[model samples]
Target chain A: MAFDGDQLSALAAVVHEGSFDAAAQRLHVTPSAVSQRIKALEQQVGRVLVLRTRPCRPTDDGEVLVRLAGQMELLGRDAMAQLVPAPGASRAAPSSRRLPVAVNDDSMSTWFPAAVADLPADVLLDLRREDQELSADLLRDGTVMAAVTADPRAVQGCRVRRLGAMRYLAVAAPDRRDRWFADGLGAEVFAAAPLLAFNREDGLQERFVASVVGRRTTTPHVHYVPSQSAFVGLVEAGLGWGMVPEVAAAPLISAGALVEIRAGRHLDVPLYWQHWALRTPTLDDLTERVVRAAAKALRPVRRHGPPSTAG
Target chain B: MAFDGDQLSALAAVVHEGSFDAAAQRLHVTPSAVSQRIKALEQQVGRVLVLRTRPCRPTDDGEVLVRLAGQMELLGRDAMAQLVPAPGASRAAPSSRRLPVAVNDDSMSTWFPAAVADLPADVLLDLRREDQELSADLLRDGTVMAAVTADPRAVQGCRVRRLGAMRYLAVAAPDRRDRWFADGLGAEVFAAAPLLAFNREDGLQERFVASVVGRRTTTPHVHYVPSQSAFVGLVEAGLGWGMVPEVAAAPLISAGALVEIRAGRHLDVPLYWQHWALRTPTLDDLTERVVRAAAKALRPVRRHGPPSTAG
Candidate 1:
């Protein structure tokens, strides 16, 4: 649905702040006007975007449309910037919504948040995470204009660059490692011992185990530790050992809460920086910083390696 | 989704091809309105897109909504280069297509005749192919705006890069690699056996065993042969251990003489490249060369990796 500049800004404020009242105060518009614009936007899309809940949250469909609105704005601004071939493209009129960026949870736990620490405050930041493997889909669907992904391939109009690897280490609490070792923790110990996964869907632990066990199981009594900090906390507390990104875990390990379970065989997830293939300084700058950081921090792999037939 | 540019073309031909009788003969136009609008479009897109399509084409979409009409002329011109851009941006006046390109097979296999090579062929130069992993997608997607690929990434705006990747290999005729030590090969002896994977999937024999046996299927499939020339015919002729990419296999392997039983892992597929993000001469210069070659040579990835997960 197309929205003119004024109308879109008003609606975006209302949605982000969660209320016509709050949005009105922030946008310096009357609450009634904010209500009118949102109603109009909803009518245009033929679906309700805001639910008017206590603090208000968008419906799943509403979020999708809100995302679409955000993309259209980007595209419009980009069009203005590129299509008109002027020396310095006029600045995009400021909007309250931050440029949404989608990234993998692991990267988010590592350098992603830090990447944003450098953005202009007015640029705003919208962060989303799923998994490195699927992050590009967000770019395809226009959920975000930029993304940190495992897939190096570009989306229809996106640019791609290597962001290096996100190395993972198999670590455990110092006492727990010794206990498992002393208790005859053979490979089979993995089949029976308590394992910690970030969530019901997280497979890092299972995959790590299978890499060592040679076979995987469908059922295991697993402790679900959802957040990055929480997952590390659980591991630090010795709930069970899990694979953790070296970046975020190194500092914690030095404090004596955790210890490396095995010294070799790190899992390196190659990461890539992908963004709309537009000629915008902000996007380009973000790409440069990300690529630089990944290069400085992650282990590097030769561009072409001896071919293999294994996953 | 299909537009009736043919009707319009035939009609336009009636006037351009001139003498309703000749235009009708050329366009199979029934003569009446073909004569009428031949005069009309001269007014519409504002230029004579086609003087004739006796096997003829267009003047410009810029003059009007002549997208399909202009695209046909552009594509015909590009049967060689790669693509024609928007109906709007013709610096001075739209003209010919140019610069032929090459690509691999896989990308061509999936992108269909279109995919990345979706741009019209308003320029010149025939699209061609050779490798399947590198520039094929660039050719297909117009990334190199051109390429030859196996499983290589499409050059951003070009067609295919390499077809991306297809792991191919060689297995001897009993006497070839091990002096009749053939059939007894299924177990531990295969990893470092006189193995063959022309480029990389050579450990394939061992990988096959791994699926049938273990993950660290300790086998050493031999050397990397990057060229298709040595990969296939060389392997078929019973040369020392050789692994070939998939595209080169069919004819020779199908003949029932050569046998490749080596198996170890999933072929590694990695494609990469970058292209001019904007529609410019250099970018266009490379696209057609890539896609045309991809269409004729490459194959597709069996499945798109799962729908990319988005936040």
Candidate 2:
């Protein structure tokens, strides 16, 4: 059976607006009209789609339709952009489209915004900052069209591409370096010193310690500072040493604000771009821009095969 | 049948350090000694306490021991402070203590730091900034000893106290207000105009819309700027109208950078202070400071009845 696009759109509107009355206003129709369309659609599907509560929520069945509606909207916008005359060519104002993308906090603070700047002005970004390890979940749940995630595996019906790696260097203030590691950078010194972590999920420091000590080591005194800028600032102010992103640490190291705690030791976190497999102009453009920018700013992935196979 | 304090401390150290060897170093004992203590503790409890992972994690049983260790540490410090003379009086260095507290992003950006400044110098603050709606979850999981949350319900083993409400006003750039809302703050204007949201979880704008239109309304165009400062800046730049915290909107309103879309129509999010029920001196001091600061910065919650029993 053919599903009506208008009914699907109405369902999406109600879910997004959180009520039938609001959806009606947005659709430029009466509240009863909005209610009737939703009822007809539900009857056709023989399934309850939405829970009519304050700030309405989608039932599991409703979510399936909402995802389809969003994907359809994105595709429709792409087709319109290609078919319509360029903005300056006509008196009619060009319409903008919203593109939701999930990104990790570290990437957001470091290099993601610059990549977004390269997208067409007609594409409005609805950026969601999530943990890298969890951003892929957003894609799986249909909360975002694409995500920058640490997980290399693609979600069902999605495609994944390697986006290089973000490198982190163990860094500390000069005085902290002197006070904690005066003897040398060794496991013993690392065990005794206080450390700073982004949060409980931050395991970079522990990993570094494991690499140095040849085993997992406990950090007795840890300070958790969750903000990206503030985390770096606390490190600079001599609060404690931590793993600083190379992008944020390079300038600080040169300016003498931070010093590498251990030379020739760092962690590289591989990142991947995951997006819906649907081939659309906007998603293609976004993917191209992000890949190009990441190639320049991040360390390229080391190929396990010959150079000819690498790209 | 009593649990030894040293073994419990060793278990906590391993969990915190993420490795037995590191815990040993922090405890000033041999790695074998640390291992033996943990083994004895596990044997005594007849449950697997610590998972031997790269960064040691607590099993369900281990988590109980970890929580107990943390509580014991807090209580021990309070006892020492009361029994001993001030550090400077006898020329002996005072040992510092770590205190982990969860706070909402809005509070962290506004008045929460002032409350922290009142904490004793010997107290180290490990501040975890979580969404107001989710901060209480941290307390439930024993990730933090206290939290500033929007939820009035107390987590198990925690005490809850109301701390006024954070007021938010619907605001937009002056030019955007003139262009889109010139007709007035009606449903038609809201449906057509772009809006700003902190993230997908932020429903303040939707809530405000429901309040104004007297029903839930769909916002077709939205820009999600996750950072608090950036979210406000985008609204000021005419990107969209959004619900800005009264604390953040006041100065912008005075500077003429922003205009209120609906005057006198605002949303007040009631906030509550939740902390472990343990009545230690440090926790009491923190509670007092937070309560005092909230009174000065947030809108006072109106009393619903006679003041005789009011807290």
Candidate 3:
């Protein structure tokens, strides 16, 4: 069944604001009016749209509508901006468009801000920092208009472009290397060394270990530090050996704070830019800027064969 | 049916590593051994425990076991530490413990690091940065053992203690204030002005608006910038007016880079320290350090009523 945009927007507001009263305030309507709009929409959809809890949560069905509302809002704003006259010619406020994008934490801490800085002033960015592997879910669910994802496959109704690869080197502080690897970079030593992980989801270090030793073995003693910057700090402080991004590792490697564990082993996580296929000027500009930045900051995608000699 | 600790751990490893092979590697066993352990556990439990996806996700039953495994591991580690001699007396890895804790982004950017600094060298912190309002979800899901949360209510089997209130003031760049509020803080002007939000989950600005206008209403224009530091920068750059934490805004206020939108108007979000009721030395030390830091950094919890003179 088709739903009215206004009603869907009201429903989205309720879910976002958490309470009918707050949603009413956000919508500048009376609480009763907000209630009426939601009730009407729920009736139209013939499903329970929201779970009226302390922080109102959308039901599975409600989520679909909320996602639709967000997508429509984004597309509508972009379309309006395109149709409207230039800011100089118009008497209205400057055309400020909100672009919700999901980004992985590593990129958020490193190259993502530069890409954001490259966007036009009128575009307002709403960045959701999530794991690269999970960022595609945001695009699929319409929570974000675009995402920098590790998933090379395009989400339904989305376009994907290769952004490039984030290369990581297994490194450790000199003290840690001396202490943990006194014996050599064998399977036993790699398995025993205190390894650092970004989080439970992070498998880069484990993958590195598997590559070193033909197959997965006993888990290494691990210290999980989820922050992008702090993960590097822990390695520098001799806390644990970890996979450091090539961009962040270079200066430290040269400065002697960290040394490569195996000398030649590395991991390259290829990243992609995924966005809705609806083609908006804002999305186009953002994709262009991101593609340009990734080209300079990340390893280029090899057309034929693997580029890294290390792995 | 009772499940053995080994089997439970195996299940947790599978869920944690996201694959049987990875879990087998982590458990330092053959993939077949990992499979057999899981198969035995499933037989004992009489339920399908895990959904074998690319990155394996736990079925509802699997999550219960995973949570149990995590809790048992934590308690077991703490018990071992208690039984064992202190670091100087023992050579066994110095009783290193990993404490996965959730903290708000604002806290992470500001006072949280100092609190982390106070943690003992042997206690490794696995910090997860989440919004204060949502951090409790981590505690609930057993993803973290503790959290600095806005919700004062205790999660199941968790203890809650008042940390203190984080005070936020509505502020804007001088030019923004002058241009947007030239006619004063009227509802129309407020509704039209660009506002900054941390993300979609942020309703603080909307709540503040309702408080100012004395009713619920339509949402004002918003620019969502998820980073705490970047949100402040956006406000400073005159991109939007937003509520800035007192700890962060004070220096900018003194520097005349930002002006309080409405004098004395502020929002105080009372934060609490929530942790598993299972008392452990590491958890105790962390709570103590966090509480001590919050006392110095946050506004004291008021005994009676709201303190802000504006609202």
Candidate 4:
């Protein structure tokens, strides 16, 4: 319950590393002390938190303790970020802070670098994108302060801002489209049409098909292309047709090398910027930059969601 | 570059709870000490992790560190789990292991209880769902040792196992369908029809419309129901005709309350099971249980991406 920061660190490391010997090596602590410190904490908690599993384990009760121990590390790091704001500066940033964010792969790989480049040189932005959908779990577990998501609903204690819509188009090589639909590929023809998918969830094909067929099945005629660029390439190679982000598609569409299957129709996935309701100038700045970027990048935006009655 | 567990925990707590005072309360450290601890860490990390603004934020670099800290915590918890094999255990398991798992909402809600019930009492499963589309992300992060992903391509360290297809039926109340589509609905019908969406990621309606029309642009007539059961209930109430998971609709269809829009053909969302190539028994056991559950609950045959070169 009450671990001196060092003791907790030692405990967590020892527990994580399995043997006190292993943890000691990682923590640069002695095996004897590691064992003794754990015993002491076990005594303090009045519970057996760690099991003697070869590597080691925390009991259900131990998990509670370990979770706490883990939390301890998080707090320590936030504290650390403040103490040493800049390497050379003798004075600190007055208040030390840590910004936790959850982002999606597309955003992380394509957009985040640019966004960070726009931030103050000193301001830190921690980006973690598991899935934009599950990003809220970070919030639930008290991990991140902000997230970029397609959902408008806000988590408890958070505010939501519509970022705009990320439109995706189902495109393919002009030659491929011509071949596939030369005689005007209709329903049965689509059943045999070559298709590229972003992994499996790349439902642009499904969404495109569902939009056309009133939501049939994720067409069986599908090839699973895993990466973003590859999915585009597959479409370009005349291997199949897949959904490409409008921003990414703009160049290709203009090149006349790829044809939008359904011209004038795009899947507008509305996105939202959500963050804790707490007023931090830092959060304000992040919110501003993200919204501005989203506005420029996405379209048909509206600041909408269920009534904000909770706030 | 080198943060002992203590520093990481402290930072995590501060950013997570929003204030140093709150973080102190959570970590049971004095506010002054919390302040000092963060000060020390920032010095060590040589960068500002948090914005020190309202709530508090971690810089992008800070977030990377914080994410590392979070993973450290998770690893620490697993370590603890290994130490304590089971209740009242005197020693640790022969090996320490944590099974990272990816799952979706339906499977989680429907079969999770059974799956958990079926698992060995000693092992724990960290199940994550990217709703459906983003489920594969769990594979990418290594956060999950395994996942129930829609995507077939395996991540760098995992193997793919096909489970089965989750079928969805386009169903609605007779009155609603009759009122709207006496001769079948048109493209514009879906745009104005009371479409049901689970979250922003739920693309059932869009897919449905795409089945008939070319693609769905944007639908103004919409209802955002977050809960699965509630979403189905609204559709049953004739709020709008939307695609319902076959599992949820089974009883309703049997009772003749809900009519299938396009009967016989089910929107089969073929599911996949992917796991890391770790030799841990826990991961194997979890995989077995989940795969078994998927086999029983879903329909259609299953297929895997690539073999388990995860080892």
- Interface CA RMSD, all predictions: 30.8, 6.5, 4.9, 23.2
Instruction: Show model 1 residue runs off by greater than 4 Å.
Output: A1-3, A10-97, A120-144, A149-161, A183-187, A249-257, A301-311, B1-311
Across A110-166, the per-residue lDDT of candidate 4 in tens digits comes to 444344333442343345554434866655444566788766778766788877777
Candidates sorted by TM-score, descending order? 3, 2, 4, 1
Task: Tell me each candidate's TM-score.
Answer: 0.39, 0.63, 0.71, 0.41
In angstroms, the error of model 4 at B59 is 3.2
What TM-score would chain B of candidate 3 score versus the native chain B? Answer: 0.89
Q: Top model by TM-score, which number?
A: 3
- Comparing 1 with 4 on lDDT, the higher-scoring candidate is 4
lDDT of 2 by residue, B1-311 (tens): 67798998999899878899999998999999999999999999999999998888889788777777877888888888778753421122235567889887777667776676434435666887775337665675456889888777887778999898898899998987888776776776687777888877788888888777878877766778776655666677666788888998999999999989878888888889999888888888889989998999998876563211111
Estimate, for each residue in A1-311, the C-alpha lDDT of model 3 and write its tens digit: 57688888888888867899998898888989988888999888789998898788888788778778887777777777778754421123445677888887777666776676535545767888776237766765566878887777897768888888999999998877988888876777775677788877888888888878778765436776666666776677676789988988989999998999988679888888988887667888889888887998999778567534346
Those runs of model 4 whose alpha carbons end farther than 4 Å from true positions after fitting are: A1-311, B1-3, B35-42, B80-85, B88-104, B118-164, B188-193, B214-220, B270-288, B299-311
| Number of the candidate with higher lDDT, 2 or 4 | 2
Q: How many residue pairs in model 2 have overlapping backbones?
A: 3
User: TM-score for model 3?
Assistant: 0.71
**Ranking according to DockQ, highest score first:** 3, 2, 4, 1
Can you give the lDDT of residue A50 in candidate 4? 75
Task: Give the range of the ten consecutive residues with the poorest summed lDDT in model 1 chain A.
Answer: A87-96
Q: Estimate candidate 2's alpha-carbon lDDT, on a 0 to 1 scale.
A: 0.78
